[model samples]
Target: MKRRKPRILTLYVTERCQARCSFCRIWEKGNPKDAAPAHFKALLTEARRLFGRIFVDFTGGEPLLYEPLPLLLKQAKEAGLRTSVTTNTKLYRQRAEELKGKIDYLLFSLDGTREYHDQNRGISLYDTVIDSIETARRLGEWPDLLMTVTRENIKMIPHVASIANHYKLIFQINPVFSYFGNTGLTEQDVKMMKEYIAYHKTYVNYAQLRLISRGGNSTLQPSCRAVTSQIVIDPQGRMLLPCYHHALDRLDTEGSLKKAFDSTLRRWYEKRQGTFDFCEGCTINCYFDPSFEYMRNQAALLSLSCRAKYAWLRYVERPIEEAFKNRKRGEL
Candidate 1:
């Protein structure tokens, strides 16, 4: 039997954003045009036909900005794709009802404490996000938080975790990527981040294990599974980036999703073994290079086990697990 490819489809609904976060990579002013509904439907059709268990993640400067998101998600679900989104939680309350059941999980971006968060994001956003999460909780949406720690917000990780725990929410702490548009941290900041990671390894490990055990897919697994498994469609519908960051770089595209995907994978495979000037000691989880070492050693059965464990966890124990954690922490 032929090996199955690991496939995930990400749609950046729009380039428009409301926040002026200092570290944001994709944020842009104004309502940049997005792919038309017809184009998205065509892409979805092709995606469903090609991959088994297709996973779709809708992203953007803020995906909620696209008024037609609920309609898109409804179509994706009807087509048999499990869907997710990464949003800032600003529009979450107003959109939660439309999003219910349509999305499997919501990846809400929350950096840190009010002062720290507002500093990184924009003024007064901290309260807005907290309120959004509170509303989601009341509505039983139960979204997970994606907290990216950077030089400015590294000091407040414990606080961030506490907030997640307090709200009975699962959170992933991702270190900020050193993107071209990033403000660029100093050596001291890098060291601080390393120390933070070392200190929080226990939390990070638990979160990752739980996510995998719950059948959640991560593109960061140091395996080349993405080459065979994942596909990313940008806003234009003409280019398919191998990963999110590459899409942001605006690399060459072949006009069609199939051709663009094939070309991107070929180029990636050719350069997989080569080191670039920018490849030195990076720790971005979403990148393929860091995951290569683990991917190389991972066995097929082990991979399947991980997936199975995730499914089992997601089905049986995830809800109570968070409550249990809260109880342990004396929050409940």
Candidate 2:
């Protein structure tokens, strides 16, 4: 077997969020302290040594609350790393110009239409987010949109996709999983989502489309990649061993980050990464998507087939639509 290393790093820079989403646990305990930029730079440096150039996402309860975001973004870019920031877009209207061209991609959160979004997010900032999207467009910034699918908001997926289309931004639908206390979406809901995604693939840019499903165990499973190809670090820079949603034991990173990676805690995770006792057939896209590239077993093939139809539309139909739009606009 070949060894694999981290390809993407998800940094939860802060536990401070602007809105209190009912389905999220960002504010469950209390307002946590934000990590210093130097801490992040160190992580990036170590990560690069282990896994060459990789993609980094600065996520948070609300990353915008981290005052030194611009500095961190600049540092990541200077390190020759591709970077992205995920925010609720509540502060976008105020900091549009400041964050115009800092990162490679900006992801905005939107659960559903104004009413549904406000209801789920526990805040009524939908209008502000829409306004911020406009501000990003005016500044020539194309921001992606993320909508976590829940039972209440499942049917609204297409409506949200329409909104993403209006802004010409990439859109993603991530199914809320049991890890978040069960998103309440049934098998029927997943079916509806598959159908809707296929229909939209004709008009949406495949490069900008994302469809994330629930995680759990089954026969069609691949080796989990939580601590391997994908890693999640909390605000304090402690590694969430095994996976992010369920941290078995926190790996200490106070001294050398590489030491923690090669510690007994990591070895424990590696031994039980894909076993039913540890991850329980989880299917989180960020960790599992890479498995498709090196699929060698029956489980990998089944996993790929489950989402292959939509994947086809995304890769095939999306490019054709993009070409049509470009020609229509005289850009081709």
Candidate 3:
């Protein structure tokens, strides 16, 4: 069998952000430098050549802080790659129109209701986020919501789901990682999350809900595709092999991009075949969700079945239901 190239690339376009979230340490330690646009373009080109089929995500402390983001997105699209961005939605409100055609998906972070969101994100920007969502909708841009579930905001899942439903946007729920200085979820919290996802699976995007419910440090998996099917690159251009959890095993991107990637791949394979102690207990979704074929466990079967059911609902049932409703209103 041929080795599979990474299918996803997360680019930290810049290091500056407006919000000082309670959980994130990025703000506490200030970012004094931003990645150059030329470096970004070069990296994207090499990335495209390495991975024939790729999805590039432009993330940041806040991607909007980078002025050349539009140019970068345009370049990636012209290279025949799909592009996406995850933002806090503060700056997007002003530039959604400019970004409408460039980005395939625009993800907004919505932790909870106004009070909850304001409290968790450590800023009074809930109303601004709402405005940005409305602005994107008005400009005919496809916007989605990402909810980082923590003790402070987990109870507001249903409310946030309703907001996504109201806007007809995709709602993605992810549990807060313990590495971020936040308390990890308890057994009770996990149970509540499972129940909530099951209940609202039909109300929002079924695929995303299913992904979130199955997320976290899953013990049923054999290996991860960190270097094979997914990777995260910091703004300074170093690549994180395996995942962000193993941040120490970073490959410098100062020389030949292909050479660096090959070395990283070798390192990843060695880790997998050798002691393999590092891969003992980790279930980061970015590494697991997209690399399901490598998971020889019961959760893999569950993932497939859940995907099939949701795929049918999203592609077959929802369209028919919408058409019926439209015809009933004499609009179809």
lDDT of 1 by residue, 70-179 (tens): 98999899999989887887788888888888889777788888877877777557777788888887876767777776667877777776777677566666655556
Residue-level lDDT of model 3, residues 141-198, one tens digit each, is 7576888888667678888888877876666776665555567555567667766663
TM-score of each: 0.74, 0.82, 0.84
Clashes of 1: 10
Model 2, 295: alpha-carbon shift in Å? Answer: 3.2
Model 3 scores a C-alpha lDDT of: 0.70
- Sort by TM-score, top down from the best: 3, 2, 1
lDDT of the candidates, in the order given = 0.62, 0.71, 0.70
TM-score of candidate 1 against the unseen true structure: 0.74
lDDT of 2 at 185: 50
Error of 1 at 103 (Å): 1.3
On TM-score, the stronger of 1 and 3 is: 3
User: Model 1, 76: alpha-carbon shift in Å?
Assistant: 1.4
Q: Give the per-residue lDDT of model 2 (tens digit) for 1-332.
A: 66777668888888888787877777665657797788888888777777777888898788898888888877778778879887788887777787777878687888888998888888887887788888887897867787877777767878878888786666766666555665545566666766777324322211112223233444345356556666788888888877777777787666577888788878777766666464664545556665443447654566556456445554565567778988999963
Model 2: lDDT to the true structure: 0.71
